[model samples]
Target: TVFGLVVKDYDGDGKKDIVLGGNFYQSKPEAGIYDASYGLLLKGDGKGGFTAVKPQVSGIVIKGAVRDIKEIKAGNNKLLIVAKNNDKTEVLSFK
Candidate 1:
């Protein structure tokens, strides 16, 4: 259950990358909670192919139930603002 998504060239390869945030706190009793996903980073190859990058490698781990993701420019830097439920907001920048 992806709650948030942002597409941009995070790796400076001229190809688009994807950041995914997903979590669900509510579900049926049989289904239990949907909180397994910490987040995911998908790097595109510009040929309709994508590779999943681990959070450790990407350094974009987002915990909790994500609600939204926004891109903002802070002076000379571009940043990602992640919003989640019952959790502190996360700000991210790629080096």
Candidate 2:
């Protein structure tokens, strides 16, 4: 089975305005070959819908898949996201 996911803002927003990624099953027969999906940036409309601002494609080559996302306050008008990429760790920030 193909493993994938979708993410969205819990608050009211027409745009998704969030990042989502996961593992996916291979369509063609390949041995020991794994493809990583890209991260997406969503935009919320504040109405109740979302649009994909960015498509899913890996920007960074990490060790593993991003299992979870945690948001933290980085600074005024800025936020940080701590994610677990397989056995490795990564940090993403936004302003």
Candidate 3:
């Protein structure tokens, strides 16, 4: 249920990419009573659509999950991710 993803050009290719973190509901019996949260990297196709690039696990525990993501500006060719863990804070970087 998260939105408003921040987009930027981290690779200097003139195409804006987006970072997102969220969860996908899993069926109780099929998924063994657990949900999946993921941190995703998407590259803009320059035609109003995006393609998935990187998908990583967000948390380790059952309740731990990623709530939000923000891009930190640290000069060109670098991007910082301020990820909100279940009850803590984490920082991820893309360079």
Candidate 4:
């Protein structure tokens, strides 16, 4: 199941993109737990529409079922810090 989503300009092209987080590894959602899901990136065409795109951060596949997505700004950099339930967080930069 899809757990969280983020819409932002990932490519710095003035177009908003979509980053979805969720897990499908576990067929069923465990109670009080975040289900595992892969991340899917969608590129926006500046016209308020989007298309599925495989997101990569520094050529690494960024996928996980994050219970919370917190956007952190470190200087001019934009990053999505994904936090899981009782697990270590992952930092993914879509730059």
lDDT of 3 at 43: 77
What ranking emerges by lDDT with the best candidate at the front?
Answer: 1, 4, 3, 2
Q: Give one digit per residue, the lDDT tens place, for model 4 in 24-44.
A: 344446544444446677789
Full-model lDDT for every candidate: 0.88, 0.47, 0.55, 0.68
Judged by whole-model lDDT over C-alpha atoms, candidate 1 comes out at 0.88
Q: Which residue runs does candidate 2 get wrong by more than 4 Å? A: 1-16, 24-36, 55-63
Clashing pairs in 1: none
In candidate 4, stretches whose alpha carbon ends up further than 4 angstroms from where it belongs are 24-36, 55-60
Q: Please, what are the lDDT tens digits per residue for candidate 3 over residues 18-87?
A: 7666553443665563334445667787788987774443221223355666777576435454445445
Off by over 4 Å in 3: 24-34, 56-63, 75-79
Cα lDDT tens digits, model 2, 15-66, are 4455565543433565543545545555667666666553333232323455
What TM-score, computed on C-alpha atoms, does each candidate reach? 0.91, 0.53, 0.62, 0.71
Candidate whose TM-score is highest: 1
Q: Which one wins on lDDT? A: 1
Candidate 4 or 2, higher lDDT? 4
RMSD of 4: 4.1
Model 2's TM-score against the true structure: 0.53
Q: What clash count goes with each model?
A: 0, 16, 0, 3
Error of 1 at 6 (Å): 0.4
